[model samples]
Target: MHKLTEIIKYSYNLNLLYVEDNDEVRNSTMIILREFFKNITVAENGQEGYERFTEQKFDLIMTDINMPKLGGLEMISKIRETDNEVLILVLSAYNEPNYFMESIKLGVEGYLLKPINMEQFLVVLNKVIQKVQLKEKSRTYMSLLGQYQEVTDNSLIVSKTDPTGKITYVNDEFCKISEFSKEELIGSNHNIIRDPENPKEFYEEMWESLKGKKQIWKGTIRNKSKSGKSYYVQATIKAILDADGNIVEYIALRSDITDIMNQQKQLEDLIDFSIKPILALIEIVDYNNLSKFYGHKEISHIETVFANTLLQSVPNKKLFDTVYTLSHGRFAFAKDANNQDIDEIIDNVKKALHNVNSSSFEIDGKVFDISIRVSLSYGDDILENCTYGLQKIKKGHSDFFIANGLAQIEKKQAQSNLNTLEMVHTAIKDSKIISYFQPIVDNKTKEIVKYESLVRLITPTNKILTPYFFLDVAKKGRFYSQITQIVFNNSFDALSKTTKDISINLSALDIEKENVSNMIFDLLEKHKKDASRIVFELLEDENVKDMNVVKNFISRAKKYGVRIAIDDFGVGYSNFVRLLDYQPDILKIDASLIKDILTNDYSLSIVKTIITFAKSQNIEVVGEFVENEEIYLLLKELGVDYSQGYFFGKPEPL
Candidate 1:
């Protein structure tokens, strides 16, 4: 038969990838693709091809189901996740019906038999092109949907109310902000949301503006949600006038400025009842080299002395305000910027501090001068406000300008809610942080498959301290390791006490450092039963470096007969599409997807697609946060390998 090279050249030019473990088949396949296509990428196994896919976008992916390092089904599934539009045609030598059905489930455009098909390959490409085009359009639509959602879900509550003060329509975003659904709000008056904090005059002026057909009226109103959470909404309302010069409806756009108002109040407090005198960032600047640079001792001393000097000279300083030491030996202080000339004040203070550093008392009969740099600011302000304007004073000093670095962390509010988090944190430290386990059941057997360790902090003072209370703080510091240890130790201890397999979380940090993993391994070796019964559900975002820390830990754990699974894939920072690339033994769909899986067909479809993809890779799948029987059944029908949620049982301590 004539070479298919002429046929492909005359039709469309493209690069083709052929991946299979068999050396004979690999070479033969490469020759065939090269005959038709000028560029043919070949890999010995699916794993290498999968890595190649990440490095480059391929027009077509052709692989056999059975391969050495990784399987074709897995690579296909991973490819389908990100670039569904790409043509994925499986060329397994075996005509296994299950493999074909599985391929079809993952949106595999086409499948071809082995012994190579030049004629059949061209035919399959035509079919795949159509599916790929359709898939591309669908992808674009989904992307557009996401953007539309972001716009509609602006933090502000935008609503339209009639001149009669009756609420008429509200956007889903507004409903979410108000915690009231469209059904609960359509006919209800805006008064339903008016909190007691909002004065009666607020409504009086709002109506006056609506009646007069005013162009705009701006005001702040306290609104109460269905959950009774009070929110301050900054709103701008306008008139929608008819041709008759009569106001028919109103247009209102609101932003929930609760956090804004809180910050404003804090700034106002800093300005008024000013006590602490410093709000500045101090950095050691030698420009090129900062290691053991000038001002090392001074910077350290500033941490302890700045407060004392500011208080001694101006003794009204408040001790409660915090100081932060950032990465790269940068120190910062934030407080009231009311009275003092910060530059001149810091200048004099810098001179005095310089003196302290310059004169070193006899130390081992040798004198050494301490060199340091001090940079000060009134407040560590937001980037938008401080950086927007051209202010020379803000960038004080020539060599060591104020390192006005923007911070993303939410600073502890001066007063309220601080103790709530602290008390909760303390409660957890004192053996709280309640943990429970829910049985991961088998899909086919419906049997209690495994128990996944979970945690909640129960305070010593008869209060339930939730993960939200301390997790963010815990993640910010070195506390993460100890926290992970607690979870693992308790989980292992609980498992040893019970007769069941247990899965525990390994903080991404723990795996990266391997401190906790090695510790656990040592303990498990001692326990004898600990290693065999453990499953580590790693977060999809678990940092993977050159060592592939998470993968290494998984491999090490697997050597001990333990299983590795990716947990909460697709939520937070994790790109779950890549999670499929790892092809863990088990994949747990995040609770966010399962939350509205009942009503949200998109979420259900994702669960179904993930399940199909996982099964084809010889991976089991689990659905988390199934709140009710409806969610459970929905995931079960979708063929999710396991289901864990309140519908079956809440996480309970053994």
Candidate 2:
């Protein structure tokens, strides 16, 4: 009884279609049918049964042989034309051999006598159920296999070989990467593409792992393509085993690493022969602006013309060992300084650049005036020092500067950066990275509405250092995310203790990092109730590369009722178009603009324009650096929504 109950429970999930013309017979069978199958569709005739089959899928069908308007045998014949796999059984009163022969020809699983015997019905239904279970399992396995094949074929170079290491299958990616057709690759030995540069020992170790130990082998390999060009792959090879644990075949998956390998080799070569102790870098002035105005192709032509003119101007090419093109319209001429007169080379380079600048460059019949800056430095870190000199020249009126003086300053700065980085590490380890809240007030009521969380690092001596002292160094050391996390956690803790809303700062860099963004969203989900009181102040110091990322983040944040504020609205490429895209809730005027708003008309005019724009968009404006009553009152009169500065309260622990 327990065994039969288990069988019936298994059949409960299967849908069955039962057709019988007699209403009395159908009602009598329904009692037993409902016990075996929970989902049973009853059809009065063969035509109705065929319609039900067409409307929906059924795992099993049982029909009486004789019926009006299409007999059961004819319906079975029609169904078999489309589907040969559906399980069918005949329950008929006719005991003629022809009926049995017709049922056999129609592919019925069983034929029961006139009045069905319950034992005989159960025995035959069990066989049909077993077949259904097997088909379902097979279908599921094939679906999973197809999905795996799709992913592997799209993303990787996949190939399979027999136990004897003869290639039997290769995906399209493998053939494409190797520049070989499937016909050319199949049945070929795996060694056909192997580079001779890889020693015999390497192949021995790989095969030993696959054939002897039946373990996976992973390595970087250099293989030659059909064109005899070398390529690199990071490969993983594993042996497929039979049930008896004997090797059946081997499958290999590889990712092309040719570019990465080539880059490493180029770096190695550069280090070996290209670097020199003394270097001079010549850069075109305002190259970024030029590129922006002219576009990349035109600027590239201009760069080529400039480079050719420089080469022509320099008579003694031997003066520099190698001329390497650096990025951003800069070229470095490097040479050893052991016996070379660095000043003479610098003077000659300066003269060459002067000649190049005097010449006019024409593109598409449009003439352009060009200027150049030159920096000369002698040190182990020649490139870095020369770059520093170029930046200093961009600030001043000098066209040429020897970077020896700047190198001393750079050495001190490097030491300072190292010290700051060490301090950041220590602060993080000691849990001294903390946040201080500065009150932002409602200008009309002079009531505190929210606070901005500022990050501060406490030194071992308990001295509080602002981001200016360590943030850039921390970013270089990859500690910026850790610091942002700490400040975020501390700010949230502060939010829990107070009712006033809290704002946290996020830079474009922070938004670009996946882990940081994930951490933020996870916290928002965890603290659902407090999300409405939270605000994110986007710092505009760095340009955001992908507006979509920021837009998506803002969209998700708004879903949790969190508001966004554009920090430092009047500076660093902040424009109206960005304003529309971000649709921020508040705009904070930069301190530089707000500090001199009282005396400087230009600053006042800019502030007025910003406030006017914000008002038009219905965005609140916060005046930062409101040091005294005069600035606060002026801002209030101008209809600014909020005020934040030392006048309200300096940033301090809650």
Candidate 3:
């Protein structure tokens, strides 16, 4: 009774068309139709029904198999030529299988007897309503998904593999980053780009998480390009599961973090290397102040001429092995004090500075007199001592300074770090960690659909600070997880009061921690009704230590109807194969890509590809950093489903 009532309610809003030549039969059926549908167009014959269909759209059409001026089957056949989606029903006295077969061939929704049965008619009507409603819902969902896929595919490195780990599909980003053509990757094993430096144990652990445990595998991976050039990626690998929960294939989503990895390597190399003794630090006195009189280009030219003069003025080039350019118009000349005493090396550098200070430097078309301050230091910690002596020269009325021992620079640095650590501790203890809500708008509708929760910290002075200021310090002090907990809890509390969905940012490290994961699960259980509205945005900046843990959390959260979104996708470290494990509901395109989409061809191409892939997967995409009207409209034209940034509104307290 409930189902029938619901069907009748749905039918009320639907427009239907009825056609019959028999006056008694048509009038009787019209009574039944009028009961369910208010807007029904009655046609006397097949020709009239066809004309009514052409005039306006109808949800359901009922006609007799045999009718005058054109049979009912003939009218339906004509309607099928123009429209394939409308529901059709046949009502006739013909009991033969030939009539039934012919009606079926005409794509009739149901074939009833001359005298309609009330129960039978209602049941058939219910089925038709279900079909109509399902199709309409599917269409809307796919349209949204298509837009998201376009944005996601363009921003991330995505690829898919068969059940046995054979490459099957690769997006443009995957090929561009890996330096392999689609043709080369399609039939090859995933190991084609694998860097041998990654030990066998690494692969073992990854497979154990993905294949054996049926979980996601995430980690930083070193891979070789097609030309054998090494590159690094933060990878997420997962097994794609079928409706029956069986493993079907694999997908990997990766972000290219090669530049970040290289930078880290460079910093480590610099730290590991030994500094040369007998260092001389030289700086153009009041170099920054020179910007007041000269343009940046002229100032730069002046610095270049001064540096060249100092190098050329050196009596013997062998005295200084290297000349290092430091910031703010400073240079460091360093060499070993093996056989030559510190005094001798210092004297030689003194001669170079004397000659440079006395010379008239020509920069561009102007000649200017340049004076430099020199600091000389030897023995252990030559760099630090020379730097300290330079600072003294800048303050005091002196052109020269010599350091005999270590300065208090290290102590000052230590004190600064300690101060930052103390600030982090105080913030955490006072429950100062909070989240700000940024509106995410639908591209087409230009309306706010959801809000992304951005983490912010309040200082002791009550000033709000973004994560950029103190997040790393908090991590160093082991308070990073606490901040995540605070933000997650606050976002859920916000979700309770609002009808719109709220997205909370999270990283793999957060999932690895038992306490954080436990809190998240508990919250979902505590607010079961709001679970459907909560979105967890997985941050791709950090590496995942255990893919299984993250995957398990995702799987569990999904059971509560919580959605997962990949945050900052396409800037780096995305894999399509890994998407299978995470199966994200949304992909938040990195701001870097979105900001440059109009000007950068690569960015536009990447966004388009992401949207295409997202459409196929039925995932939504949220474009970040939509700062202006032009960008928002372009995203809509490109079929991006949602957008987020300052253009709609900056992050604010909700």
Candidate 4:
């Protein structure tokens, strides 16, 4: 009680006058108030209180309504005439309706009755303290706000919006970042900051989190700054709340560190330059950075070492590229020469390098030993004008012979990839290719609703060759579109009568070709009835490399009502979050998992998970390799809606 009274006591330079006719009540209150308050005066009667209150410039006036002479109500009304900002409170029997109604016009902040409970008095007194502190805090906040505006007004982006996530106010920086001016963006959502490369999942996750009461969130954001310049920043978003605990606005603080990001990139490039050509069989796929493998400084050092060794070695008729160690003890390569017998070439070169090491180069301080290999191409490896056939030799492996550049098989495989391309081309020219069908069944209906048309080239020996034999090669050459169109036409002709839809996989390469869409639309127009019975199976192959192309193709394809199935679903590096972007009608689950769908719980779980995801996206599921009764039954039980394989039917002559 005492502490609360002391805290509420006035401390300003303005005058304070307290009136209480009771001697004890007046004396104690005056002493406590005077201890913390300045310019204090007391009046025994309402008359004196009014006189003193009018005489001085007071900030607060407290009095009992039951006081003598002029009475509290009359004194208060007179005081109200002189001041409005001054806080007024009644401390006596002030519960009467008339007294309150009249005092209300006097702006009394609080009123307490006679014989006040100490606890209630303390609560009311603390409220007065709060009011004073609130006024002081408000003034301080205003001053700080001015300083804050000065510090960040020019650099930071400031935006204010109503509770609904629409933009209401945007500063210069916000306008600069979003490229939309205050006028244009005021009613827009914050999506203008979105980047093309950003995955959809991040936004989905963000919105999900934002809907909750989370105060702030941290995430790496990629946004297009006003001038269509993309930048990355670590952003923190905070929700500004009102007194009722409802979010009224959101503030985003983003710092541009594009230079720091670029420096990090350079540092990564430097690291790659130092330790590449790892000689280890681990696949490194940072699709953004591939040229780092060609380490200029290290490669040059290796070349010099090999060059010195070549200079010292006795010249021979067999031309070969050779590498020798130098000052850094790092060795590299034999330059591809015009006439190098690459086979005997590597051995003689190694011998020459060894000879130089033994005779002249010293065993220097902390020298690193090095091993290298060379490759050879003689007959078909050579193009019509070119002479030698060594495509590439990896200076790696457990095979010591390979280290010594004597791996005959390494040279043979290079010969095969080169030979395979020609063989595939010759096969296509000869019309050895045959169309095969992989029945695509509706798992829910347990029937073949579609057939995914596959292309195969059967050798005269009756060996069935998969499309892999020629597709990659054909895609590289100009023959892909012809083969795709032929397959499409053949499949349509084969299924012209059946109610079942025939899906044909067109290489994104086919769609990218000139007149592909026109040709398809023309073909479909000729077979409008047949086209509805067809599904153009889309694969995220070459098209996935550029999303805009894929989106454009799908958007155009969708207009034909032919239904699009994402072929080899969940098998590629497609962003699953953006799966909705393609809006596929069917998700042809990849055969890699379908091949053993039943026995492996892991594969079953994955298929089930994909089905659940696809269901949400309104995509039908199709199983490819339903080879046995058990597999078929298991997939059906596991909620797989489709089954197609030897168990149901195989591709036979139409």
Predicted model with the maximum TM-score: 2
lDDT of 2 by residue, 489-566 (tens): 888878788999999988866786668999998888888889999999987643676777888989999999999999
The total number of steric clashes, by the backbone 3 Å criterion, in model 2 comes to 0
- Report lDDT (CA) for all predictions: 0.64, 0.81, 0.79, 0.60
Report the error of model 2 at residue 350, Å.
4.4
Predicted candidate 4 versus true structure: per-residue lDDT over 611-641, tens digit per residue: 7666655678777777888877777886767
Q: Number of the top candidate by lDDT?
A: 2
lDDT of 1 by residue, 1-654 (tens): 224444565324565677888998878777766655666678889899998888876777888999877899988888878876677778878766578667776866566778765545666665555455566789887876765445544433568878676888898667887788899999898778778787788777777766752648887777888888998766778888774456778878775557646655554455356553354444434422422222323333443343333333322334224444432334344555457566665565455445544544333354434344554434435322222221332355442334343332223332334555565557556877656888877766778868988776776667655567667766654455676767877887886677778988765655655466688888678666567788888765524543355556666778778887888864431133344344478888889988978787656645665676577778888888877778777777778878887776777877
Q: Between candidates 1 and 2, which one is better according to lDDT? A: 2
Clashing pairs in 1: 279-377, 280-377, 294-371, 294-372, 295-371, 295-372, 433-456, 433-457, 434-456, 434-457
lDDT of 4 at 113: 58
Best-to-worst ranking by lDDT: 2, 3, 1, 4
Ranked candidates, highest TM-score first: 2, 4, 3, 1
Residue pairs clashing in model 2 are none
- Give all candidate RMSDs, comma-separated: 28.1, 27.1, 24.3, 28.0
Cα TM-score of candidate 4:
0.43
- lDDT, model 4: 0.60
RMSD (Cα, Å) of model 3: 24.3
